[model samples]
Target: MQASPIYIPSESMDADAYQQPMPQTANTPSLENPEDSVDDSTSRESWRDNKKPRQKALYLDNDSAPEHRLSHTLQLVEELIKEKEILEANKELIRCVALTRIIYGDGHWRLAQSYANLAHGYLTLRGLPAQAAQHAESAKEILLNGLDMSKSDEEKQAILGTLVTLYYTLGAAHLIQNNGRESLHNLQKVEKILEELQTLDGGKAVVLKISEKDLALALGRASVLQNKLNSAASYFEKVIDYVIMTEGDSTPELVTIYQEMAKAEQSRSKHDRAIEHLLQAHSIAIALYNKASVEAAEAGLLLAKAYAVSGNYDDAAEMYFAESLRAYQAALGPDESETLNTLVEYSKWLVQIGRNQEAYKLMNSTCSSHLKTSGDFSETVAEVFHLMGTICLAESKMQKAYKLLKKCLEIQTAVYGSQHKKTRQTQELLNMLQKSPTTSEGNKTR
Candidate 1:
């Protein structure tokens, strides 16, 4: 975890720093056209006299060449995709698809590439899994329909590259759509082809540019969707091994591997192992970022949750949770609103286990922080205060509970008028507190 900055930076300065313009692109020089060459059969001297020098120069400088225009236009989509501007990339992709279809018709390889790109765009951006599947299927079907069965192995392998990308996209889309069976089917097909290529290339299939790591990652995700946890773990283990061998711990892939592995462990109720994996992810995240980072806090939050659900109510478990909470705070900073999300999850788990004292203490801390950060009238502050008031009433602190509850009611009424659901709920809490602030029974402990 990183030390919090002693001083705060101005938000406007940060915004200005982030708005720097992109660098300009350099122009490609014109190339000579071989088709415009002088006939050697008519001797060099004869052609040199007949062929106008201007004609040769004009051919070499043909800026409107079809191949050049196609390449330049296609590059626009590629660059946008790299920048993660999916909407802009999709627009460029549509233009390329239309141009390619006009130039070489529907079944052409170039047109198929554009379709595959459109699928990629849809898959990366949420709310379009069906569209992603549509384009992926179109690319695969077009390639299979156009290519001859009798084509050479080299030619087939070349086309299969595109098919491999299409298959991966199709599998990802199916997974997103919760069609696990279909997702697994596509992933299996990709794995088979990759295995065959590995053998044929004598283990030098890096030329294919698709590593075993990539295939394993896809298969692992598919297996997870199918509820095949054991198989998914094995696949993820392979991917983890590959990432460690090639990229080491500093890369983001290593962090993701640890996170997913932790999830698998958590599913099996292997809390100790899950905690270990989450810690590993957290340590790696610390190296990747200098300060409070979303990824690091996520790892810490997962660790805290693991401790809570590990079915232990001992002092050790309590201490572990406390440390995990500190890590969350350290990685997420003092008062980022997102901190509430993790705190809420942890508090709910505490309430589930009947650890009311710990839950109350946590709620108190959260409410204090919320009050300090954005003050009394905020919705989050009111919510935390309401929780604190409920806990106080349970603990039989009548006066304390009444004060906290009334404060929460006032905040809600001010922000959301008395007719609003939240305001009404707060009013109900206040009414209940007034009617019975101190209960006959004492709070129960786990």
Candidate 2:
């Protein structure tokens, strides 16, 4: 929940860095139509080499029976993810996209939802940045175009809900790109759409019970990006307000809301308030761990951080390490980046607590694994290197430290201009290294 200072080493990193993947929508409410199979072979033949033809009625819902198979596809994706089979989950999402593209042409709401969901799948599972951005953009295009169509209030609300997803997805992508301004723009658009939806016919009653919760999420994220910590806290509080008013305290939704509130309060430096919320989140997670590992891990992480800040370092460290390990195990194998990131964070905490040797070993393993999976200059790779450099410096491995630090600086300079905060920090570190007693008089290598 506490965003790390290890941002991308690029000017755009500030813009794109916060672009965490949007959560996938569940049990997508279908428009009134019967479900049918998408003729994949026919679709491939018909559109294989051809471009999508623009239809005059872009918003027209298919009068033909809608594919009932889609509902099952979503269920399968959820199941796959729950089982920690992310690769399979990703495959299912891609199938959904290919099949949906055939059944619902480009620019259709259903197609857009498919794209949005696919983006989330990529983000949560593989951290496929480019794929995530492409799908998000596709979803945005479809939802924006659909808004002009003649639809009922209910239908319009449904469309808006999808649009919210699209905007948030784009926002997240931009955040990762270090394009903070663009991310903020997309997030504000989501906020605007949600504001309108909330006023429509006594709330558009989104099929996803978490629609407003997501809206609050967008606002909280945007506020954080803008450095409006108090505002972020208020937005997260709104999630609690909306859920308590609608679903009451007993729902799983309350658990999620409380955790988010804890994060927002922590960001705002309200440690006591954050601790209170996290305790509630932890209690719920303990009760519901068998039902949802995702929620359980989330609550555990929040509680861990809260405990750490409250001077319960021993317990906090244990919880942090344990939660990180749990997340790694739930990643359905070693290919998931989010799981790796969690591990990296845990290792950083270990180092902070004077467990330098353990931290070094973990960082070494993490760096090697990241290099093998992520390209040489990936954000994650850069972060791994930076952490390694920090460890080496701690151990006074001057040459090794300089080599790693220089590489980290180079990556940051390349991705985020020399003027960027990350790049600047790396440069400062390099300068300090040059002036160290270990360095020769002619130390101008960096």
Model 1: CA > 4 A from native: 1-68, 71-92, 121-131, 144-147, 177-181, 196-211, 287-295, 313-317, 327-333, 345-362, 372-383, 402-446
lDDT tens per residue, model 2, 1-446? 11121111111111122346444444321212101223323423332234223311111223433365455566666666656666656755766776586677766788888877777555546555556777778777777673564677777777776676667667766665556677778878876766666655523245431244554655676666777778778887876775676656666756766776777687777888888898787777668664236566666666766766766556765665576557555743344555556566677777778887787787676546655444556565567678878888888887778877788887777777789988888889888888887754435554
Off by over 4 Å in 2: 1-252, 267-269, 282-295, 332-335, 372-376, 417-421, 424-446
Cα lDDT of candidate 2 equals 0.63
Q: List the residue pairs that clash in candidate 1.
A: none
lDDT of 1 by residue, 229-319 (tens): 8898899888788678666657776787788888887887778887788778877877886435677666666666776677763454455
RMSD of each: 13.3, 13.2
Candidate 1: 10-residue stretch with minimal lDDT: 5-14
Q: Candidates' TM-scores?
A: 0.67, 0.44
Please give the lDDT score at residue 223 for candidate 1.
85
Candidate models: Cα lDDT each: 0.62, 0.63
